[model samples]
Target: MKRTTFSLLVVDDDEDDRMIIDDAFLEIGYAGQVKKFMNGKMLFDYLEQIDPSFYPSLIVLDNTLPKMGAEDILTLLKESPAYQSIPVVVYTTSLSPSRQEKLLQKGVYACYQKGEVMEKVIELAKQLRELAESNSPKE
Candidate 1:
Protein backbone atom coordinates (compact mmCIF):
# COMPACT_ATOMS: atom_id res chain seq x y z
CA MET A 1 0.00 0.00 0.00
CA LYS A 2 1.07 3.52 -0.70
CA ARG A 3 1.74 5.95 2.17
CA THR A 4 0.73 9.55 2.52
CA THR A 5 3.13 12.23 3.63
CA PHE A 6 2.44 13.99 6.93
CA SER A 7 1.86 17.68 7.49
CA LEU A 8 3.47 19.00 10.70
CA LEU A 9 2.67 22.11 12.69
CA VAL A 10 5.58 23.17 14.88
CA VAL A 11 5.50 25.86 17.57
CA ASP A 12 8.79 27.00 19.01
CA ASP A 13 10.26 30.25 20.27
CA ASP A 14 13.94 29.66 19.63
CA GLU A 15 15.28 30.21 16.13
CA ASP A 16 18.09 27.70 16.59
CA ASP A 17 15.79 25.01 17.94
CA ARG A 18 13.45 25.62 15.05
CA MET A 19 16.37 25.24 12.70
CA ILE A 20 17.37 22.03 14.40
CA ILE A 21 13.91 20.59 14.02
CA ASP A 22 13.83 21.61 10.37
CA ASP A 23 17.25 20.13 9.79
CA ALA A 24 16.24 16.97 11.58
CA PHE A 25 13.32 16.54 9.28
CA LEU A 26 15.66 16.86 6.35
CA GLU A 27 18.11 14.41 7.89
CA ILE A 28 15.34 11.82 8.20
CA GLY A 29 14.31 12.56 4.64
CA TYR A 30 10.82 13.44 5.74
CA ALA A 31 8.47 13.70 2.79
CA GLY A 32 5.89 15.77 4.65
CA GLN A 33 5.38 19.49 4.94
CA VAL A 34 6.28 21.53 8.05
CA LYS A 35 4.73 24.82 9.13
CA LYS A 36 6.37 26.72 11.96
CA PHE A 37 5.24 29.42 14.38
CA MET A 38 7.18 31.39 16.96
CA ASN A 39 4.24 31.70 19.29
CA GLY A 40 1.00 29.95 20.09
CA LYS A 41 -1.18 32.94 19.35
CA MET A 42 -0.04 33.03 15.75
CA LEU A 43 -0.46 29.31 15.42
CA PHE A 44 -4.00 29.55 16.77
CA ASP A 45 -4.85 32.46 14.52
CA TYR A 46 -3.72 30.49 11.50
CA LEU A 47 -5.45 27.31 12.58
CA GLU A 48 -8.71 29.17 13.01
CA GLN A 49 -8.83 29.84 9.29
CA ILE A 50 -7.98 26.33 8.20
CA ASP A 51 -10.51 23.58 7.78
CA PRO A 52 -10.36 20.92 10.47
CA SER A 53 -10.28 18.23 7.81
CA PHE A 54 -7.06 19.76 6.54
CA TYR A 55 -5.39 19.91 9.95
CA PRO A 56 -1.79 18.78 10.10
CA SER A 57 -1.08 15.14 10.83
CA LEU A 58 1.21 16.01 13.73
CA ILE A 59 1.93 18.94 16.04
CA VAL A 60 5.44 19.34 17.47
CA LEU A 61 5.42 22.03 20.15
CA ASP A 62 7.90 23.43 22.62
CA ASN A 63 7.38 23.39 26.37
CA THR A 64 8.36 27.02 26.77
CA LEU A 65 6.76 29.56 24.47
CA PRO A 66 6.48 33.34 24.39
CA LYS A 67 2.79 33.48 25.17
CA MET A 68 1.11 30.12 25.54
CA GLY A 69 3.14 27.08 26.39
CA ALA A 70 2.83 23.55 25.02
CA GLU A 71 0.47 22.48 27.78
CA ASP A 72 -1.91 25.30 27.03
CA ILE A 73 -1.90 24.52 23.33
CA LEU A 74 -2.42 20.84 24.00
CA THR A 75 -5.35 21.64 26.26
CA LEU A 76 -6.87 23.90 23.66
CA LEU A 77 -6.51 21.30 20.95
CA LYS A 78 -7.90 18.53 23.12
CA GLU A 79 -10.92 20.61 24.02
CA SER A 80 -11.73 21.36 20.44
CA PRO A 81 -13.84 18.70 18.82
CA ALA A 82 -12.44 19.50 15.43
CA TYR A 83 -8.81 19.19 16.51
CA GLN A 84 -8.80 16.45 19.11
CA SER A 85 -7.78 13.75 16.67
CA ILE A 86 -4.54 15.37 15.55
CA PRO A 87 -1.47 13.98 17.28
CA VAL A 88 0.78 16.26 19.35
CA VAL A 89 4.42 15.65 20.23
CA VAL A 90 6.04 17.83 22.84
CA TYR A 91 9.68 18.67 22.19
CA THR A 92 11.51 20.45 24.96
CA THR A 93 14.96 20.92 26.44
CA SER A 94 13.78 20.26 29.99
CA LEU A 95 14.23 16.75 31.34
CA SER A 96 11.09 16.36 33.39
CA PRO A 97 9.86 12.83 33.21
CA SER A 98 6.88 13.51 35.47
CA ARG A 99 5.79 16.41 33.33
CA GLN A 100 6.17 14.29 30.26
CA GLU A 101 3.99 11.63 31.77
CA LYS A 102 1.39 14.21 32.65
CA LEU A 103 1.42 15.47 29.10
CA LEU A 104 0.96 11.96 27.84
CA GLN A 105 -1.99 11.55 30.17
CA LYS A 106 -3.37 14.82 28.90
CA GLY A 107 -3.36 13.40 25.37
CA VAL A 108 -0.07 14.26 23.71
CA TYR A 109 1.22 11.48 21.46
CA ALA A 110 4.81 11.64 22.73
CA CYS A 111 7.42 13.76 24.47
CA TYR A 112 10.97 14.17 23.24
CA GLN A 113 13.73 15.89 25.19
CA LYS A 114 15.87 17.92 22.84
CA GLY A 115 19.61 17.38 22.82
CA GLU A 116 22.65 19.12 21.32
CA VAL A 117 24.21 16.08 19.70
CA MET A 118 23.65 15.64 15.96
CA GLU A 119 23.21 11.89 16.26
CA LYS A 120 20.56 12.28 18.93
CA VAL A 121 18.81 14.91 16.89
CA ILE A 122 18.84 12.61 13.88
CA GLU A 123 17.43 9.78 15.93
CA LEU A 124 14.72 12.05 17.25
CA ALA A 125 13.95 13.12 13.72
CA LYS A 126 13.54 9.53 12.65
CA GLN A 127 11.19 8.88 15.56
CA LEU A 128 9.18 11.96 14.77
CA ARG A 129 8.92 10.93 11.16
CA GLU A 130 7.72 7.49 12.14
CA LEU A 131 5.14 8.98 14.47
CA ALA A 132 3.91 11.49 11.93
CA GLU A 133 3.66 8.89 9.19
CA SER A 134 1.95 6.37 11.40
CA ASN A 135 -0.70 8.83 12.50
CA SER A 136 -1.44 10.19 9.05
CA PRO A 137 -4.98 9.94 7.76
CA LYS A 138 -5.89 6.49 6.60
CA GLU A 139 -7.02 6.25 3.02
Candidate 2:
Protein backbone atom coordinates (compact mmCIF):
# COMPACT_ATOMS: atom_id res chain seq x y z
CA MET A 1 0.00 0.00 0.00
CA LYS A 2 1.10 3.58 -0.64
CA ARG A 3 1.29 6.45 1.74
CA THR A 4 -1.14 9.33 1.51
CA THR A 5 1.60 11.26 -0.27
CA PHE A 6 4.16 9.41 -2.37
CA SER A 7 7.81 10.41 -2.50
CA LEU A 8 10.38 10.02 -5.27
CA LEU A 9 14.17 10.14 -5.34
CA VAL A 10 15.89 11.14 -8.58
CA VAL A 11 19.63 10.99 -9.17
CA ASP A 12 20.81 12.85 -12.26
CA ASP A 13 23.60 15.30 -13.05
CA ASP A 14 21.90 17.04 -15.95
CA GLU A 15 19.92 20.14 -14.98
CA ASP A 16 17.70 19.97 -18.05
CA ASP A 17 16.92 16.36 -17.43
CA ARG A 18 15.92 17.10 -13.87
CA MET A 19 13.61 19.87 -14.99
CA ILE A 20 12.03 17.66 -17.58
CA ILE A 21 11.44 14.96 -15.00
CA ASP A 22 9.87 17.43 -12.64
CA ASP A 23 7.69 18.82 -15.39
CA ALA A 24 6.62 15.37 -16.41
CA PHE A 25 5.61 14.49 -12.88
CA LEU A 26 3.72 17.74 -12.53
CA GLU A 27 2.02 17.25 -15.86
CA ILE A 28 0.89 13.84 -14.76
CA GLY A 29 -0.44 15.33 -11.51
CA TYR A 30 1.78 13.12 -9.40
CA ALA A 31 1.06 13.86 -5.78
CA GLY A 32 4.50 13.21 -4.47
CA GLN A 33 7.69 14.78 -3.28
CA VAL A 34 10.40 14.61 -5.90
CA LYS A 35 13.85 14.88 -4.39
CA LYS A 36 16.73 15.65 -6.71
CA PHE A 37 20.42 14.80 -6.47
CA MET A 38 23.05 16.13 -8.85
CA ASN A 39 25.59 13.46 -8.03
CA GLY A 40 25.75 9.90 -6.86
CA LYS A 41 27.85 10.79 -3.82
CA MET A 42 25.17 13.03 -2.43
CA LEU A 43 22.48 10.51 -3.28
CA PHE A 44 24.37 7.74 -1.54
CA ASP A 45 25.04 9.89 1.48
CA TYR A 46 21.40 10.74 1.74
CA LEU A 47 20.33 7.16 1.35
CA GLU A 48 22.75 5.86 3.93
CA GLN A 49 21.65 8.41 6.49
CA ILE A 50 17.90 8.30 6.02
CA ASP A 51 15.66 6.27 8.32
CA PRO A 52 14.45 3.09 6.66
CA SER A 53 10.82 4.04 7.24
CA PHE A 54 11.26 7.22 5.22
CA TYR A 55 12.74 5.65 2.12
CA PRO A 56 11.29 6.96 -1.11
CA SER A 57 8.54 5.13 -2.92
CA LEU A 58 10.83 4.85 -5.96
CA ILE A 59 14.27 5.82 -7.21
CA VAL A 60 14.78 7.23 -10.69
CA LEU A 61 18.45 6.80 -11.51
CA ASP A 62 20.67 7.74 -14.43
CA ASN A 63 23.11 5.27 -15.94
CA THR A 64 25.95 7.82 -15.89
CA LEU A 65 26.27 9.65 -12.63
CA PRO A 66 28.94 11.97 -11.32
CA LYS A 67 31.12 10.63 -8.48
CA MET A 68 29.81 7.05 -8.93
CA GLY A 69 28.50 5.06 -11.88
CA ALA A 70 25.13 3.29 -11.99
CA GLU A 71 26.63 -0.16 -11.56
CA ASP A 72 28.37 0.72 -8.31
CA ILE A 73 25.36 2.50 -6.87
CA LEU A 74 22.97 -0.23 -7.95
CA THR A 75 25.24 -2.83 -6.41
CA LEU A 76 25.36 -0.97 -3.13
CA LEU A 77 21.62 -0.48 -3.03
CA LYS A 78 20.80 -4.07 -3.89
CA GLU A 79 23.28 -5.35 -1.34
CA SER A 80 21.84 -3.23 1.44
CA PRO A 81 19.03 -4.87 3.39
CA ALA A 82 17.18 -1.60 3.89
CA TYR A 83 17.20 -0.52 0.23
CA GLN A 84 17.03 -3.71 -1.80
CA SER A 85 13.25 -3.61 -2.02
CA ILE A 86 13.17 -0.03 -3.20
CA PRO A 87 12.46 -0.07 -6.92
CA VAL A 88 15.05 1.61 -9.15
CA VAL A 89 14.30 2.71 -12.69
CA VAL A 90 17.18 3.46 -15.02
CA TYR A 91 16.57 6.61 -17.01
CA THR A 92 19.41 7.38 -19.37
CA THR A 93 20.32 8.49 -22.85
CA SER A 94 22.23 5.27 -23.43
CA LEU A 95 19.98 2.83 -25.33
CA SER A 96 22.17 -0.22 -25.42
CA PRO A 97 20.44 -3.61 -25.10
CA SER A 98 23.41 -5.12 -23.31
CA ARG A 99 23.48 -2.25 -20.86
CA GLN A 100 19.77 -2.64 -20.21
CA GLU A 101 20.23 -6.35 -19.70
CA LYS A 102 23.07 -5.69 -17.31
CA LEU A 103 20.96 -3.33 -15.23
CA LEU A 104 18.05 -5.76 -15.26
CA GLN A 105 20.43 -8.43 -14.06
CA LYS A 106 21.49 -6.05 -11.30
CA GLY A 107 17.84 -5.94 -10.11
CA VAL A 108 16.63 -2.68 -11.56
CA TYR A 109 12.83 -2.54 -11.88
CA ALA A 110 12.96 -1.17 -15.40
CA CYS A 111 15.19 0.70 -17.87
CA TYR A 112 14.19 3.58 -20.09
CA GLN A 113 16.04 5.83 -22.51
CA LYS A 114 15.59 9.52 -21.97
CA GLY A 115 13.39 10.94 -24.68
CA GLU A 116 13.96 14.11 -26.69
CA VAL A 117 10.23 14.67 -27.12
CA MET A 118 8.03 16.03 -24.36
CA GLU A 119 5.13 13.68 -25.07
CA LYS A 120 7.32 10.66 -24.79
CA VAL A 121 8.85 11.84 -21.56
CA ILE A 122 5.45 12.45 -20.06
CA GLU A 123 4.41 8.97 -21.03
CA LEU A 124 7.49 7.54 -19.39
CA ALA A 125 6.73 9.50 -16.25
CA LYS A 126 3.24 8.05 -16.19
CA GLN A 127 4.68 4.59 -16.49
CA LEU A 128 7.15 5.31 -13.73
CA ARG A 129 4.34 6.50 -11.52
CA GLU A 130 2.55 3.20 -12.01
CA LEU A 131 5.69 1.21 -11.28
CA ALA A 132 6.37 3.17 -8.12
CA GLU A 133 2.80 2.84 -6.94
CA SER A 134 2.91 -0.88 -7.48
CA ASN A 135 5.95 -1.23 -5.28
CA SER A 136 4.69 0.94 -2.47
CA PRO A 137 4.82 -0.62 0.97
CA LYS A 138 1.71 -2.32 2.24
CA GLU A 139 -0.09 -0.41 4.91
Best by TM-score: 2
Q: In candidate 1, which residue ranges exceed 4 Å CA deviation?
A: 1-6
lDDT of 2 at 132: 75
**Clash pairs, model 1 backbone:** none
Summarize candidate 1's per-residue lDDT along 52-113 as a digit string, tens digits: 66678888999988669888999999999888998999989994888888899999888888
- Residue 109's lDDT in candidate 1: 85
lDDT of 1: 0.83
For model 2 the local lDDT of residue 44 reads 76
Clashing pairs in 2: 1-137, 1-138
**Which regions of candidate 2 deviate over 4 angstroms?**
1-6
Worst 10 residues of 2 by lDDT: 1-10
Worst 10 residues of 1 by lDDT: 1-10
* TM-score for each predicted model, relative to the true structure: 0.88, 0.89
Q: Kindly state the number of residue pairs that clash in model 1.
A: 0
